[model samples]
Target: MLDHCNGHPLAIIALGGVLATKKSLDEWESVCKNIQSHLQGDEESYSGVYDVLAMSYYDLHYNLRPCFLHMGHFPEDSRIDVEKLYNLWIADGIVSSTQDQIGKERSLEDIADDYMNQLVQKGMIQVNRKVSDGRISSCSLHDLMRDYCLEMTREENFLQIMYIDEQQNASADALTDKARRVTMYVGKEDGQSVLKSLSGKFSSLRSLMFISTSTEQDEDEDSCEWIRTLCRRFKLLRVLDFEGRVVLKGTFPSEVGNLIYLRYLCLKGTRITELPSSIRKLKSLLLLDLRVSRVIIKLPNVLSEISLCWLYFPVRILSQEYDNTQGYEIEDGSQLILNKLSHLERVSEVDLDKVDVKSLLERTSMRNLSATCRQKKESLVPFLKSSTIKHLSLKIDAGLLTGNSEMLLSKSSSLRILHIDAGSWPVTQLTIRVDMFPCNLVELGFWYCKLSEDPMPVLEKLPNLRNLQLHICYGGVEMNCSDTSFPELTYLELDGLFFLNFRNVKMGGFPKLLEMAIYNCPLQKIPDALHPGINILCSSILDPLANEYRLRGKASEEVQIPNLNTASEEDQMPKLCEFPLLVLAIIPFVMLSFYFCRSKKH
Candidate 1:
């Protein structure tokens, strides 16, 4: 298989995928011989391996063909997030939602997830990473497979890819009527030249994605004239995804509102400072991704059509950066709150902490939000009860996690998921009163809050909390879980607590806990609540005998462990004897202990 593949990755994966379905050894032998015959007999200059790969592609489930093929639109080997890709697929109506899936109470996203998992299992796609929820968060295709995909893209006009490094390849074929989707991978600084050269060529284009491969300053990107021209030319565009690489030093042109049919507009990693007030004209816009764009502020208020927004940065940073430019408007101690662009309403789902509470009240359509910008306690107090917010993640840097959170609970009584990530401040205990958290919170994840005091008694009262994750970055002595606490929690994940004392478990303690994962912790004993569900991770365990010896104050064992190199001395693995038994003891508790044992022995 290796020899026939001739160092091509796609062929190897395709061969493996085909063989996985063939259970008989004779069938495998026949398939292997036939593949070698094809490779040896082929005289064409094109990749012989693509023949094998084409079989895999053709064998794909018919419903997934278009969805898989459409991936050619993205740059080769792009790390496409599942959220982004699934949304794109759904937006394009590539995956049809069946009644069977719906009958199982599965969403289209759930069915799509199943499809992606099957594709990965069949070696058609590669999984990059999985999140805590056991969902594939990101994925990438092999370069060779991406090349084959691009070849098919050219033949079927699926999407046009223009390589800036190879100007000769940038032909009129891309500007033809068939080219509906075009992606410009700017590998050189001459993108301005290329754009100017291809001026008026994109008439019928629907989707235009720009991926900047050049690190140099793209000055042309800052100008509104080129953008206006592009928007004016491509009046029928539905998706304009810059992939957040273009740094718009100026305002996003008002001409963008002219594209009445636009649905998805992503400018996540850009330096876009403001949105022109004219943007409210986009009546068809569904998603507006402005996440991580620190310079953005003063959004147009007339947008009632937008359903989802991805703005995660704080607004204070925007005020700080642009305040000097508008120095003439400076007043007394308070910064002038940028009001909404008139009385427009219904802005849903955002991280708009930087916006004034007065203006936030007008945005009555807010759903789940994660805000980093701090607001005056009094100013935020009223809306806590008035708002119908569900999931809330407040990144309170000024130690507001312990603030009067009861105001939050009172206002957003319908809150379900609450994530509080403590900022730079060092908190050692729960300062907020017992009634701060809402009784209906179903999930909670806290990060970096040093909460020295265990407030389990308060959290225990939350009747709906089914999942809880605590991630403390620094060293901590212990966190005590009291009797009958977290009774409804189905999943409990604790990380970075050096010591954890599960001191007590009264009758019916954690009655619904199906899984418990502990990481980077030194838990000496198993709690009475421990069942087959408890998972003491490899990174958290120590050999009982070794720990006992250490308790007896002896480092007598000559156990050698690999030492991590601090200096750049060719990464030599020198021996060190400090607690190798931790590595040895971690074997039995692994998810599949027998598999781990076999691998360790091998």
Candidate 2:
């Protein structure tokens, strides 16, 4: 059956999809002959793929067309955020919530999510990133799928994307009355000219996105001028995304309030330290994304101007970032954050210092809450007591997290999803008892903690946990599992366990564990046993073994095999030359072995 069709994967898959319905041999051969004859003339890979993709595209539910096509507006291979994308789809009037007489309802967001899953299953898109709770946070299209999107978008007059990298700038000849939305992906400095010349050129333009092509060294000297120029020309824009750029000299331009029709404003990567008061004028705005950008720092204290006093000061501040290689001090911003940010909604995503957690609890009723707890607020019992908050993402401070501070998460009857991120804190080695965590947590993400102690004992007590991730716990000793651990955990991931000892785990420890991953960890091999149901995905197991070989002076040593080779073990250089590699690899293992030996002795 496979011999009749060309070896093209898409062609084979498409033929298989068609052939699955055929019950009789005659029906199968007749359909097979038709496919084989069709392949006789058009042998190009694109043709085969086009037919397969087209067939699958038409097979989609009618309501999914616009949502699927809308994704083409994003830059090729772009990491499209699911929340942002679905919100855009909703705002674009592409999909809406629906309920039948049977009382089953599907929200607009849910519909978009289902469409995304459909596309993913059909191999139209790939998951690029997942959030702490294992939801598809971001996804990207394949090169072929992206190309198809471009072709379909142009043909349908949906969205016109202009690239600054291409010669002659694709927008020069492409702008027309039909182009309702324009996305300028900046890759070169000449993007200024492209925008300057193209202002007011498209009367139908309702959405304009200026995405930075590169995050490195993007110094937009005339970004203010660009904003001024854009506002002057495009007055009808519903979505103005000047995000991921250093906007208006570290200040949000006050004129942003003038865009009364604007619905979404994303300023995630901007250098803006203070939001101008005029922002409150955005009455039509539904989402105001102001997430701080994540930058790697050699010295965490360098951003002390902002991060310091994380406990009490108003988060909003008028300040410059750490400019010099040697860091600089910041002016005290005690009054800057409190007085400036006056428009705090009841249930909003804001800086920890922006609004008091108490103030938020009093003002409104909310189902989801995200709050930051500085070292000062380590006693999380107050926030956990809030009965309204079911989904909570709490940011933790890393400085010596051991005090009288205890997080009895199980006691929080409301909290189902608890995301704990110890941002930029070094956990050289910290012991956390099982009593400190919430027992009823359905999802727990202990990321960036650099824990040095075994977490299995601490986590396995959570009977209701479905998804658990222990990421970047660098100085960990071992991941030991007892017999009655993880009774209901479905997904378990242990990442960045750089110095793991890879010790004890019973075969039936995680009886209900559906998926398990141990990545970027120094584990030579899986434990000798595992539950029959657990999919223990321990990739990069070779890295530790490679280190082990380097330890025995066998990494690059010439072996004494009785075969035709250049040199034998004794014929090589002296032991002194191998000293560095020996210490680099073997000394640690020796210490680990000694520790185990001593442990057994004890």
Clashes of 1: 4
Among all candidates shown, the one with the greatest lDDT: 1
lDDT scores of the candidates, listed in order? 0.56, 0.55
Report how far residue 566 has shifted in candidate 2, in Å: 24
Candidate 2's residue-wise lDDT over 174-216, tens digit each?
5676687777776545436656546557786778776667656
Using TM-score, give the best candidate's number: 2
Question: How do all models score by TM-score?
Answer: 0.59, 0.66
- TM-score between model 1 and native: 0.59
Q: List the residue pairs that clash in candidate 2.
A: 409-438, 410-438, 410-439
Model 1, residue 461: distance off in Å is 16
345 Cα displacement, candidate 2 (Å): 11
